[model samples]
Target: MNIWEYIYSPIIIFIASYILLRFAGKKAVSEMNSFDLLFIVVLGTIVSEPLVDKGIPSALSYGLVFTLVYILFSILTLNNKLRWLLITTPTVLVRNGDIDEKGLRKARITTDELLGTLREKGYATVKDIEMATMENMGKVSVIPKSYARPVQPSDLNLFPGAAFIPIPLVMNGQILMHNMKYLKLDEEWLKRELTRQNIAFDKLDDITLASYNAKGQLDIDTDNDEGHNHNPYMYKPGNTN
Candidate 1:
């Protein structure tokens, strides 16, 4: 009833809820397995004790502790070894265009489920997939067979090379020495190039990007450092004044 209890109650409940969820395990929400679902429901009911019992702030305290525990556990899992404990490795449902019946059974995925997932991914038949994987997230990934796959640019007789040669320049408030070395360029050359284009060096910082195309055409993107509204995103690197 007191203001202190009112403010602290929710905090406690949240912590307790979080900790209980963490204890239940990461699979508890993401995997959507039957057992994990049951555990979460039961845990939530048990952690609701203090909320119903007005005399004791048990629910709030429990919730607060639970939340902290969940967060800490997540952080721990993000580091090296502990991560595997929280998440399962991806399961191969199909390999080399062949279905892995044993792996499918282990993953608890039915044939219908597998086919449905493939269909959703534009593979109406099993033969269409060269490889099928049931990732840890429980989503089925399908790689189309070479014959069934769409033709890429290379397949259409296009040369597999850079669409445009990238011209590198320094624009992030510091001279990019590595880029200059890579391009066999120098500061003096850069200054002269900018001078030829009638651009100021101090205003170079206004340039978000600058590049050169394959033909060695300099592309300089710049904006008004004077705070005038301009389309900064649309400005290409070498198109500056």
Candidate 2:
């Protein structure tokens, strides 16, 4: 309630949280497994107690001590002998397009779960994947078979020139002035391009999204065809019109 408690406590808590999170490593936060999730929940409860409870004397000091202890243990776990005690190694779920049933059982993941993860990653069947690894953080990383991979423009010996990142000029009927400025483009140039495409200045509201690349490729999507179904593979290199 006091000014010191309000400001000081939050600053201390934030610093402690940041240190603890950094010590835990990136995977602990980015791709958290069941154990990592539990660790975070417990850590949150412990860290938040001192801030919430005003009756406790030396609360900030206690928090700092606890956080430092956790960081020390995290550093100790970096040793080869102690690393396995803290972190799980990645499990090979599929190898050479064959399912590793034993590995799956050890990881406590079902075949259906593995299949579902593969499908989410664009692999429809296990045979399409050369290797599927379940990372320590519980994320499925896949290596597709060479035959299943799509051909790149380079494979066809086509020099399409350097591709520039498309900058969005408009989104949901609003002009993105910041993106225009970043691309060193002005409103007059955009207006001219829109007018050339038969889009009137006042009719800009009809456009849902509009982007342009350095190669003069302008992509425009309008709100008029929300229900339109287009083939995704139609734009592929060898696809017929």
Candidate number with greatest lDDT: 2
lDDT of 1: 0.70
Q: Write the per-residue lDDT of candidate 2 for residues 130-205, one digit (tens) a residue.
A: 9999887778899999888888787889879776778889998999999888878888888898888878878889
Residue 51 in candidate 1, Cα distance off native in Å: 4.6
Alpha-carbon lDDT, every model: 0.70, 0.78
CA shift of 239, model 2, Å = 33
Give one clash count per candidate, in the order shown: 24, 0
Model 1 TM-score on a 0 to 1 scale: 0.47
Per-residue alpha-carbon lDDT of candidate 1 for residues 1-241, written as tens digits (9 for 90 to 100): 7789877776776775675666656765786633345456655765666556763355545555655555576567677787677757778888877789998898998889888888888888887778888776667777888999988987988878767768567566556778788888887887877787777776687777777567665677676445433756545566471
Model 2: worst 10 consecutive residues (lDDT sum)? 232-241
* TM-scores, all models, native as reference: 0.47, 0.61
Candidate 1 C-alpha error for residue 228, in Å: 41
